[model samples]
Target: MKVGVVTFPGSNGDTDCIETLKLVEGCEPQLIWHKSTDLMGADALILPGGFAHGDYLRPGSIAQFSPVMREVARFAASGGPVLGICNGFQVLTEAGLLPGALLRNQYILFHCAWTHVRVSSNRSPWLEGVEEGTVLRMAVAHGQGNYFADTETRRRLVEQGQVAFEYCDPEGNTSGESNHNGSVDSIAGVTNEAGNILGMMPHPERSSDPLLGSADGRVLFESLVRSMAAGAVGR
Candidate 1:
């Protein structure tokens, strides 16, 4: 499978995302600059984590206007899959590709650590390998990872099963300590109405390798590849 990893001027995790994807057998990731206007025929697109524009305007405010974002928006609208991690998730929300917005952590600190995530839905291709309610460990690094939306939107997301993942305890349980960043309902990741777009503050690609101490993230990526490949073959 061919995936496109986009790089903005201040993007820091572009290489990491590319390397992680390349590590997957038969999966090749192409690097596209933020200035590029096309997707280069990639089957999927990943907006890797980074401090684009140095987080000048907002986490993803400046990035939403980049030339590459136009292509991303177009691709997502056409049912192409797009995964946005960390800053990438902020960008997706800023670009209007995903729902809700991210705010500073309730504690107002830069958080970086291994946080557990519970799969709330398998409706998205990105979570096909994960069963609903299964908990997986993922590394999260961000400051403004807290997500918020109006009550109606949150209700709609829940009703539609667009809530893909949530913060959880190490024992696969939900608790106060399990909810990092004080996100609303402990939401860690979510998808669009059609389940073609996914955006989350946790870095799944960062944990695709077991040597990195957490291989749980691989299932999400592998699921994406499998789901997309299946769609390609009319399955």
Candidate 2:
């Protein structure tokens, strides 16, 4: 699978995502600049974590206008698999590819630490084949990763099984304390209605190797590869 990792001006996680993709069997990664519209015929797309345009105005405010994002949006509308991590999550929301917004951390701090997230939904191609309630170990580094949505939207996400990941304990239990960043309903990640696009705060790219920490994140990446091989994309 050819995965395109988008790199906005201030994107710092593109290298990490690319390196991780290189390690995933059968994953071919291509670095994409924010200015380019050509997708290079990528099988999947990844908007890496970073402070695009220094996160000026808002986390993804500026980056949303990038030319590449138009292409990204187009691909997403076609049901292509797209994963947005951290700032990428913000961008997805801002671009209207996904619902909700990433507000500033409630405590007003740049929270960086490993967190436990349980799979709330695996309907998306990105998390396809991942069992619900499976706890995953991933790291989050962001100052504005608190996910928020309207009351109705939140309820819909839950009822529709679009809540992809939720902060939880190692045992797969969620609580106020377990929900880092105070995201509503412990939402660490969510997928679009069609389930092809996902916006997540955790950095799975950084957790692909046990040397760095837990390799739990590798499961999601591998899931994508497996789903694609099975011709289950755009689901």
Candidate 3:
């Protein structure tokens, strides 16, 4: 599998994401600059976490207009798999590739720590093959990781099974302090209607290796690889 990792100016996790894809998934990593339109024939796309354009215009607001995003948007519209993490999540929202918006943390502070998120749905190719209700230990580091959508959109998201992951306790209870960001309905991740694009605030690349404290995040990447391979066979 060939995975394209976008690297915007000030993107800090581009290398980390590249390493994760190569080491964890044994996939070829293609570093795509924010200014380029080429996708290098990548089968999967990853928008890793980082302060794009230094987050000068509020998180992903500035990065959304980059040249590369146009192709990314096109790729997603054609049913390509796209995964956005942290700042990437914000970018996806800004690019109109995903629904809802990421707001400031409820505590008005940057949250940086290991957190648990339960798989709410496997309808997305990114989460396919992963058992529902499984608790994944991943690290989240961001001030604007809170996910919110208006009442109507929220209802539709739930009804359509677009909600992919939710902040939850180790035992899979999604209530109270388990929601570190105070996101509405404890939402941690969501997928597009077509289930090919996913946006989430957690850093899955950080936890893909057991030596990094946990290997739970590998489940998502593995599922993505499996789904891509299956798609190739079907084609």
Candidate 4:
């Protein structure tokens, strides 16, 4: 698998994503520059987290207009597997690839902490082997990681099984204080209608290694690799 990680002007998580991809056998990771239009034959693409363009004009608003994002949009439209982390999720929403927008944290603070997210849906290959309600420990670092969508859209996402992950307690309780960012329905991640593209606020790449306090995030990458080996579609 050739996994490409796009590096925007201020993106800081590209290297982390590359290293995480390297941990998976048969995975060749490529670091693509934001100015480059070509994805270099990537089987999957990751838009890692960071304050792209210094988060000017509100999070990903400026970065979404970068030259490479045009190609990213095209690749996603073709059913290619695309994963967007924090700022990347903001970019996806700004680019209209994902349904909802990311708002600033309800507490208006840049939160950096370990969080537990439960696998909420199996509609995408990214969760192929992860059982529903399985809690994964990951780190979330962002000021605008809160997810927001209109009521109808939220309902549609749930009904269509597009919800991928939800902020929850270690025991898989999604209510109350588990939702630190105050995201609607505690949504930590969600997939596009076709389940090929995933946008989430958590940094799974950062939590993929044992040295990172938790290896729970490995399940997602492992599942993706297995899915690819089995010739599974993102759907």
Candidate 5:
């Protein structure tokens, strides 16, 4: 599998995302520049975390207009798999590739720590191998990771199984202070209607290796690889 890792001007986790895909999935990692129009024939694409354009005009507001995002948006429209993490999630929302918006943490402070998220749905290719109600230990570091959506959108998201993950306790209970951010319905991640695009606030690349404290994140990456391979066979 060939995985593309997008690197914006201020992206800091590009290397980590690249290494995780290469080492864990044994897939070819392509470094895609934010200014380029080419996708390098990537089988899957990842928009890693970090402050794009120095987060000058709100998290992903500036990065959404980059040249590369044009192709990324096209790829997603054609059913290509796209994963956005942390600030990347903001970009996806800004680019209109995903629903809802990420707002400032309720506490108005940057949250940086490990938290548990339950697999709310496995309808997305990114969470194919992950079981519903499974708890994953992942790290989230961001100031605007809170997720919000209007009444209808939120209801449709749940009714359509677009809600992929939600902040929860280690035991899979989705309530209380377990939600580090004030995400609506404790949502931690969501997928597009087609289920090919995923936007989440947690940093999966940071927990893909057991040495990094947890290997649960690998489940999503591996699921992507498997989904791509299956798609190739179907084609």
Candidate 6:
């Protein structure tokens, strides 16, 4: 499988994402510059986390209009797999590839730590290796990870199974206390209606290696690889 890891001006996790993909057997992941017009024939793409454009204006606001985003948008429209993490998640939302928006953390602070998350659905390509309701250990580092949407949008997301990942506890419980950024309904991640694209305000690449203290994030990339190999269509 060939995966493309996009690099914005301030995207620091692009290398980490590439390295993680390298850990997967038979997988070839390359870096795609923000200014590149094409995705270089990658089967899938990953938008890793960081302070793109130095987080000017907003987390992902400036990065949305990059030259690479145009291809990304088109790729997603054609049912290609895409995963956005942390600031990358914010970019996807701003670019209209994913629904909803990320607001400032309720506490107005940058949070960096190991967080528990739960898989809310089996429909997402990123969650195929993990079962529904499975718990995961991921690392998060962000200042504006709070996710918010209007009532109707929220309802539609839930109804469509677009709500893919939710903040949770070690016991696999999603409660107010486990809501790291005070997102509505404790949403940590979500997918598009077709489940071809996913955006979440967490750093999965950072946790892909067990030596990093957690390997839960590995399943996400592995799942995507499995989906592409099987030519699985969206649910």
Question: Evaluated with lDDT, which candidate comes out highest?
Answer: 2
Q: Which lDDT value does model 3 have at 59?
A: 92
* lDDT value, candidate 1, whole model: 0.89
Scanning candidate 4 in windows of ten residues, the lowest lDDT window is 226-235
Q: Candidate 5: deviation at residue 46, Å? A: 0.5
lDDT of each: 0.89, 0.92, 0.90, 0.89, 0.90, 0.89
Best model per TM-score:
2
Which has the better TM-score: candidate 2, or candidate 6? 2
TM per prediction = 0.97, 0.98, 0.97, 0.97, 0.97, 0.97
Model 3 weakest lDDT span, ten residues long: 226-235
Model 5: per-residue Cα lDDT over 15-58, one tens digit each: 99988887655588889999999999987889999999999978
The all-Cα superposition gives candidate 2 an RMSD in Å to the true structure of 1.0
Hey, what RMSD does candidate 5 come out at?
1.4
Local distance difference test, candidate 5? 0.90
- Tens digit per residue, CA lDDT, model 4, 1-235: 8889999999999999999988878789999999999999998889999989999988999988899999998988888889999999999999899999999899798889999999899777778878888888999998898899999999999999999999999898988699998899999999999988999898989998999998887777788788888888742
Off by over 4 Å in 3: 232-235
Kindly list the per-residue Cα lDDT of model 6 for residues 63-125, writing each as its tens digit: 998999999999899888899999889999999889999999988978898999998976778
Per-residue accuracy of model 1 over 1-235 as CA lDDT, tens digit each: 8889999988888998898888777679899999999889988899999899899979999999999999999888888889999999999999988999999998898899999999998888788767899988889999999999889999999999999989999767877788879999989999999898999888988888889879888887788888877783121
Model 6 global lDDT (CA atoms, 0 to 1): 0.89
Tell me model 4's lDDT, rounded to 2 decimals.
0.89
- State the TM-score for model 4: 0.97
Candidates 3 and 6, the one with greater lDDT: 3
Error of 5 at 58 (Å): 1.2
**Clash tally, candidates in order:** 0, 0, 0, 0, 0, 0
